[model samples]
Target: MNQNQSFRQLWISQSIANLGDSFYILAIVTFIYNRTGSAAFAGLFPILRVCAQAISGLAAPLLMDRLRLGTLLWMAEMGQTICFGSMCILYFFLPSQWLIPAVLFLVFAISMLHGWAIPVRNALVPRLVPSHLLVKANSLLATSDQIVLLVGWSLGGILVAEWGVIRVLEITAIMMFFSTLALLFVKDPSANVSAQPESQKRWDRMKEGWITIWGNPILRTLSYMEIISGLGESIWAGSIILVFVKEVLHKGEDWWGFINASNFAGTILGGLLIWKLSKKIENRMLFTMLISSFSIGVLTIAFTYSSNPWFALGVALIMGPPYQARSIAQRTLLQFHTPEVLLPKVFAAFGTILFVTFGFSVLLMGWMADQWGIRFVYMSTAGLYVLSAFLTLMMMKKASRSIQTQKEERYMNKIE
Candidate 1:
């Protein structure tokens, strides 16, 4: 297929897959928490999700060899469909106590397989787009994702609350099935093809991917930034609603929905802005540094000292743009420089580190919130965000300046 067909397929696939993903995530969190009235059990989700998904991610490089990326996509969908069927049967008809964990395990296992699908998709994009358009491709993906997430969270909450969790899970599973089917239309560019035989062992495949990430200073720095960003973000995503409902507003527990919806709205706006910015910007790494710094600033303001619900909601609304901006930039940078042969391994490693850090931070913040109240926990998180922004920003600024100087030198050499 031609370049245009390939790019079109990628964007369409991204939209469908991300929309299904958003639905599943919202359904799982809302369903598990609703069934058992325990925020701690709710918080157990990050632990369950990250651990299972991390294991899948670490093994993804090896699995990618045995299964085609397209085949893996279908497997993830079928697994999710069956999982939701079990959940529907249990939530609607069976009122047994043991059923909750069983459903939860099924849902989480599906997520683990889906996690394995991520790197394979990430590895596919650069082959479709030119080097200069890598940032644009990533931005498009993020924009579509944000739009889906905004609608997903808002509607998922309503679907669970109004229709019932089982119904929502069933619908989400159907969407996933369609999304998996959508991948059949993607025009695979031969640029992404790997050697016939992958490495010998699971560890061997894992090592090969890691070696690429380790060998490149840029990739190494980018991975570290993603991990730190994940940790900081966990404090906000994992605990912010608990803080708002239980501490800031002193309202009924249900207000978590409004707060989550508000923050999600902000993310949608951010994604739209980044989508436009991607066309105008050429330097993905430097763009990431700017957006990341802005994200920290917004986060500090939102979580550090908040009293009123409306004001808190406004702050939450502003948080999305910078967060998404950085995400789009980071993904593009990875796809742009990393060779296609090693892309899956590199992306899988990125997923492992990112989610693991996110899970750890959630565990820590959840504990602190339970003990000292979420206010203090959030206040500390705000400080950490500011510090990270400062350090990473300075480093990226220097890198950006150096790149400009090198370009000028190369131009001068051509003239001579």
Candidate 2:
């Protein structure tokens, strides 16, 4: 198939897989809580999943170096499908004492495979689309992601209640099967077309991405920004948000859901705005990213101080566009700056950083919420955002000066 067809297949596969993921996660969390009657047990699901994904990301360069991106993606989906299908069977046959552990193991296994899929899929976009279309492509992908999250989570709970957990798992398995099938048509000629030298050590291959990030000034700066932002973004974690709704807003579970939905809606709007302004944004990615970063910092503070539920909802909605803009710009910048051969590994390293930071940040933010207040957790996150923005500004100036030096050297060579 042609590049356009391949890209379409990739997009469809991701959308379907994400929808299945939503159902699968909701089913598993609900099942665990219902069976155990413990919020702590249910919470372990995310904790385990994050840890597993981080571990997998750290090792993903090994696979990315050997397999085509298309192959890696489809295999990840297939592995998830098999794991979920097995979970459905084990639910019926396994003894009560063994079932939760079995299910949790399967969850971790599935998440490990997912860790590989994310970087592979992201690395495929630059190969499929021209550089000029990178912003629009990333915007479309982000929009679909938000849409899937909104639809899947909004409908998943109801579906689980109606269909029962086992049936929902079965349906998700089927959806994943189709996602794998769609991925079968995807082609990424840029990946794994040649064998690596036998002299390269496995340890060296694994650390290659981290080395690349360290050597590149832009990637290093971006990594620092992501680390800071990831910590700040943890304030949006469900547990923190739920607590804020209860303790600060004096609101019910429905209000929590409303706030979440509003945030999703705002992100969807933001994605559309980015898509519409893709050309302009493409030319000034750093500037756009900087502005969006500051906007999010300001909006987040506004969100933290609002006692009125409706006002908080509005602030959450306003937060979406800048958030989307910054995300697309960052992603596009990474794609443009990294070489095709190294992009997947670089993305893997970046994913690992995010996973690690987010995991720690969740725990840190949870403690702050308990010790101080939910408002304090958000206020501190806003401070982190401001720090992140200034860092980006510094990086931009350094990059500009580097470019000027290059131009002047070329002019001197011409004069000689």
Candidate 3:
């Protein structure tokens, strides 16, 4: 297949996988809660998944170095499918005393395999599309992702309600199987294994991405922003949002759903808007990102003060465009700045940081909400975003210079 066809396959495969993921998450969480009758046990689902993914991410670079990106992705998808299929059978036949543990183990296993999916997908984008189309491609993928999240989560719970947990799991497995098949058509032009000095240590290979990220000013700045933003974004967690609806808005579960739906809708709109303006925004990505971060920070603060659910929904809706714009800008910049061969490792290193921050921030935000209030949690998140914006501002010159240097190097190579 040509690069364009491969990209289409990649996009379709990822969308399908993401939809399946939403269903799988809802099914397992509901299944666990119903079986155990404990919210704490149910909550362990995300925690375990995050921890497993983080671990997997730290080790993912080693695999990325050896395998073709396409090979790694399909294998990861297939592994997840196998794990989910196993969980379905065990859930039916396992003894009562052993069911929860067995299912939880499978969840961890599946998540570990899934850790490779995002970084690999991000790495593959640059290889598939020309540099000029990177922003458009990223925006398109982001739009599809939001649509999947909106449709999948909205429908997933209902499907679980109507068809039951096992049926949802079965459906997810089938989707995943097809996702794997779609991946088979993708050709990795940069599939050659990266050679290392024979005497190099395994530790050096693992740390290569981290070193590259830290050494590059743009990537370093981006990493700093990611850490700060990850902490702030934890407020969007379902538990936190649920508390916000109940305590601040004095609203019901339906309002929580409404608010979440509004956010997704806004994001889809934002993605489309960005997609259309991608060419205009490409050269100004950093500036656009900074502005978007500031907008999100201000809007999030505004959201915290709203007692009326309608006003809060408006705030949530308005926040989506900036959020989506910021996300796409950041992703495109990462792809633009990093070498394609090292993209997987850079993404893996970046993913590990995100998982760690998100895991920690979730717990920290929960504690802050418990102690101060749900509003306080969001206010704190806003503060983090503002801090991130300032950090970006401080590094803007250096990032620009780095971009200039990279362009010069590329030009020189072409001339030679």
Candidate 4:
């Protein structure tokens, strides 16, 4: 297959995998809570997933360097297929009391593999398309991802409630297996391998991504913002959102599906808008960061106070564009700035930060939900976004100054 056609195939495969991920997450969280009747218990699953992701992210760059990108993609998909397929079988045969532990173990395993899969997928995109088309490509892929998410989030709850979680998981496994087949037609891209000390310490090698981020001012600021934003974004933990729907909004499983689907519908719209306006978006990074933080703050506050489910859905729809724009911009910026040799490590570090911060935030928010109410937790997340907005504005100024200085330095070097 040609490069463009291969990318399209990869995108479709990943979209299917994304749908499976969404389905399994909603199904598993609801399953846990339905059985245990504890939001805290359900919360543990997200923590488990993120914690495994964080650990795996630390090693993702190493794996990416050692293995073919296509191999990583196929391996991750096949691994998850096995994990989910095993869960489906075991759930039926295992003792009732063993279900939770068994599910948790598989979730952790799937998540660990996922940690490797996502960064590899992201890093592979730039290789698939030329620099000029990167923005459009990212936008289209993001939209596809969101569309699948929209379907998965919307249908997952209803399916779980109607057909049962085990059945949903079985279907998810089948989808994952199908996704793995697509990679067989695509050729793996060569890595931009960099030289390293022959005797470099393992710890130093492990810290390569972190060290790179620390050395780059823009990456440093963006990485910090990601961590803080993650804290605010913790409200998206499945159990917490489910609790909000059930306890605060007094809704059912369908409502949970509706709310999440509404959020993802907004994401798809936002991706389309960004794709159309790619040339018009001057200073993409600053605009995305500022708008993202501001919109998130506004939506969080609006959703927090809204008593009606429809009103909450309306707010969710409005939040979509800024969220999509910010993600697209951040990704574009990373690809534009970081060299290919270092990009995997940089992305690995960024993912690790997000996973670690997001994981703990979910656990902490889960406890707070029990103590202070889900509404309070939602409002608190809004406060975090506000802080993120303020910080991002400050960083924008810093980035502009850095860009100007670098331009002058390059001009002087040319003259010399």
Tell me the lDDT of model 3 at 105: 89
Runs off by more than 4 Å, candidate 3:
399-416
**Top model number, TM-score:** 2
Writing each residue's lDDT as its tens digit, candidate 4 over 303-379 gives 99888999988988888888888788878877777877777778888899988888778779989999989989998
lDDT score, residue 207, model 1? 73
The better candidate by TM-score, 3 or 4, is: 3
Give the clash count for each candidate. 1, 0, 0, 0
lDDT digits (tens) for residues 1-416 of candidate 1:
47657667656765766766666677777767777888878776667777888888887877676665656666766676677667777666765687777876875787688788778778777766787777767777776777777777667667767887667677876776676666666666554345545436657776777788889877887777777687678755735566657767776656666677776777778777766776676655565666566566656566557777777777777776777776777787777768777888889899888888888787787787788877776667666666656656766777779889999999999999
- In model 2, the worst 10-residue window by lDDT is 189-198
Q: What does candidate 2 score in Cα RMSD to the true structure?
A: 1.3
Q: What are the models' TM-scores?
A: 0.84, 0.97, 0.95, 0.86
Lowest summed lDDT window (length 10), candidate 1 = 190-199
Write down the worst ten-residue block by lDDT for model 3: 191-200
C-alpha RMSD (angstroms) for model 3: 3.1
Candidate 4 lDDT at 11 equals 91
> Residue 211's C-alpha lDDT in candidate 4?
89
Of 2 and 4, the candidate ahead on TM-score is: 2
